[model samples]
Target: MSVLPLIFTSGWASGINAYAVVLLFGVFGATGLTDEVPEALQRPDVLIAAGVLFLCEAVADKIPYVDSLWDSVHTVIRPVAGAVVGALLAGQSGSVPELAAGAVGGSTALVSHLVKAGTRMAINTSPEPFSNVIMSTTEDLGVAGIITFAIFHPVGAAVVAGTLLVLGTVTALFLVSRIRAFLRRRAQRRAERRAGQAVGPPV
Candidate 1:
């Protein structure tokens, strides 16, 4: 069977948390849970780096506005990670062209990343911080679950990932107005802060 399904699932997960995907895949590969993961990801240094970054993200992703800032930084990283992982998977499997797999993975990751980032922006508008923590935890669990499942049942996991991608996109679209408003308010607040600093206590 083609490795496309696994690639698709990984891409979807990568959008939300690329480091987690790498860490999990590395652990699974090192433990002999599966051989589909590329050797580069199984290296001890790679696993350690991914683990540390995953820890950083886990903390940063639970903070209200901080999560949004982190997402902004990862806009390019996530998609690129997805493409590289996909190409590596294709090379290992030899069941699909590297370019095709990379394209699929990169595009899927980009779409899902947008959905995640947009949704987080909308969530950030909430006054309480609990929502950010809840959402972040849920995303982490969802990524871990789907990646684990993909190792056992690639096509089924792909279906789940695809369904989630669609639902998330739709939800993000529904919350577009809120996200826009949030951005406006945040920008305005930053501007006000800057102005205040510039005035320097009216001196």
Candidate 2:
């Protein structure tokens, strides 16, 4: 089977939660749940590192500005992870197939990562904190679902991932104006508060 399916699926998952994808692959490979898992991923050090990072992400992703910062930091990490996963799935090194797989994975991951990061930035403009938690949780669940399914049915998972990528990108971009409005409102509120404080209490 061509590695394209896994490449796309991993790419999408990496955009949402690269550490979780890595941890899943490491755990699956370590436990012998699947043969397609990579040997390096099965290493204890890799598993530990991915696990720790995943934990940090799980917490940071639920905070507003913190989540944006986290996404910015991972802009590179996620795409790199996608490429690595693709190369492993290709089952070769330095060959044309592996290189192509890496390119596909990296490109796909970049698109989804941009969508995820942009959406999160937009969401952060709101004053409510719960939305961040809700969205982050949903994304984490989505990544888990897709990666788990990809292990057995890569083609189906790829289709789902592709659909999601397109829809999410469109939706986030559509909300840009609204996010800007929210930011304006929040800024106005802050300015009003500052002005009130500056004037001192009326006698």
Candidate 3:
């Protein structure tokens, strides 16, 4: 079995939550659930760092606008994490070239990240904050479930991940109009605030 499938699955998961993927890989490797995980990822320091970051993300991801800000920050981090993880997996398995795996992982992660960020932007347009929390929880659960499944059945998990990536992309596209409306409303609000600020305080 090629490690590419697992790499693809991890990349997809990483876009949503890189820290969780790292933490899960470390735990699984340390516990001997999977030997495919590299020793570097299993180190205690790595696990701790990943754990802390995951917790931070868990909290920040539930907030309405905060999650979008978090996603913007991770725009670079997620793809880089995906590439590194893919290279490590490929190096361990010796089944795929490191560069090839890295390219696949990084590209997939970038696409998935864009989809997630766009969807979150659309969700943020909602007046209620519950949507953000619900979406965040769903993404977290989905990543965990898919990653765990990938450990046991890489190909199947890859298929599932790919399907999700496609669906997410489609959904984001469908929500383009809403996103535009949100942007316009936000801009109008900002302009209004600016105009109010420019006006001198009431005499």
Per-residue lDDT of candidate 1, residues 21-123 (tens digit): 9999999999999999989999999999999999999999999999999999999999999998899899989999999999988889999999999999888
Q: What is the TM-score of each candidate against the true structure?
A: 0.88, 0.86, 0.90
Residues 1-203 of candidate 3 have per-residue lDDT tens digits of 79999999999999999999999999999999999999999999999999999999999999999999999999999999999999999999999999999998898999999999999988887899999999999999999999999999999999999999999999998897777887899999999999999996898
Give Cα distance to truth, residue 201, candidate 3, Å.
26
Report how far residue 58 has shifted in candidate 3, in Å: 0.2
lDDT of 3: 0.95
- Output the number of the TM-score-best candidate: 3
After superposition, candidate 1 runs with Cα above 4 Å error:
179-203
Cα-based lDDT for every prediction:
0.94, 0.88, 0.95
Model 1: lDDT of residue 66: 97
Better of 2 and 3 by lDDT: 3
